[model samples]
Target: MTTKVLVAYGTTNGSTARIAETVAEVLDKEGLTAEALPARTVTSVWSYDAVVVGGALYTGRWHRDARRFVRRHREDLAARPVWLFSSGPLDPSASERDIPPVPGVVRAMARLDAQGHITFGGCLQEGARGRVARMILRSGKGGDFRDFARIEDWARTIAADLTADVRAGWL
Candidate 1:
């Protein structure tokens, strides 16, 4: 049987959306039916067999909509397999450090019984916003630091887990 997967994301400068799309592509290639949609578009979790929800980080927090999405769908998400991802931390130096996951993300994970959570680097457009926004953008130490290969590998792992569940008649 085919598994329907929803790859939903919240983005600011759009890096998170790209990450979600890449994950959806990987899942599709793995023979799962997957679609990447904005978090706001997901009205209900009942339509999907599995869900991958992602968001961009700002001021060390996840986008508000993504947090709200998790809070709103916590019960339905707990009844199904779910994964979470955050796109931020453009600083390569910080990549090796173990910062605690964003607070909203932590709550979502606990509430949803999320299968996994991953954090990836994000980008910033030059001179796009004001001083504070620019400062935060600069502090992340600007760069298109996303590792597509790693992202694809993670997607494959998620697909493998879901596929195993399907074969076992547990999905």
Candidate 2:
């Protein structure tokens, strides 16, 4: 049987969904059955062998829908392999480590003992931000900072992980 993976995400301005699509594409190319879907549409994570949850951060927090999805699936997620990714750091100077996901997201990952958690650069559209946020971004931190190569590499790692787990009968 094929290993199945779900790449669900909550995105603002569609950046994170693109990231999720890339992840799912890599997983499928690596021989896993995977699909990317919005977090709001994913009623549960129980059907998949593994789950990858991605979200965009705003105001030092993950999108509300992503948090709710994690919370709703907390029990099932705890029993299976789970990976988390956040796309948020717009500042090229800001390291991935400097951006933090909301506390609820952290708690969910901790509870699930998530296999991996990654952070990637995010993109912003014009007028997407409010006054204060725009001010902060205008300080030479604004632009499309997403790195597709890096994102693809991470997805490949996830593919390897899922493949190994399935082959070893760990799933």
Candidate 3:
């Protein structure tokens, strides 16, 4: 059977969902069966051979749905090859440098023994929900900072690692 992967994400403005979809697309192209879904909609991770969890950073905190998903599926996640990602920084910093995961993500990484974690540039455009988002937009700070090339490169790396493990019978 093909290795089935789940790319689950929590997003307030939908930027993170797009990232997750990109990841799933890459994984599928790499010969793995993958799908992207909203974190809150998933009831379990058992059917997936591996999982990639992503969250949007808000006010220095990971998105609530992602946090809850990890907390709820810790056991299943720890048993498989899992990865984590966070999309937040409203600037080009994420693309320019390797931004570390937030504290909560770091802790979850340890607990779930995630294979890897990455921080990608965030996107905040007009019509984004929340007062802070509107305020940021009014302040002339809202823009799409996500680097698709970087995101694709990261997804490719993950595909390589997972495919290698599969060949070695580790997945």
- Residue 50 lDDT, candidate 2, scale 0-100: 93
- lDDT: the better of candidates 1 and 2: 1
Model 1 poorest ten-residue lDDT run: 91-100
Clashes of each: 0, 0, 0
- The local distance difference test score of model 1 is 0.86
lDDT of each: 0.86, 0.84, 0.95
56-135 in candidate 3: lDDT tens per residue?
Answer: 99988899999999999999999999999999999999999998998999999999988899999999999999999999
Error of 1 at 19 (Å): 0.3
Task: List residue ranges in candidate 1 displaced over 4 A.
Answer: 93-100, 127-131, 136-140
TM-score of 1: 0.91
Which parts of model 2 are misplaced by more than 4 Å?
A: 93-102, 127-141
Error of 2 at 93 (Å): 4.5
lDDT of 1 by residue, 5-73 (tens): 999899877789999999999999999999999998789989899999999888888987788788888
TM-score against truth, every candidate: 0.91, 0.88, 0.99
Q: What are the C-alpha RMSDs, in order, of all predicted structures? A: 2.1, 2.3, 0.6
Candidate 3, which ten residues in sequence have the lowest lDDT sum?
A: 162-171
Which model is ahead, 2 or 3, in terms of TM-score? Answer: 3
Tally clashes: model 1. Answer: 0
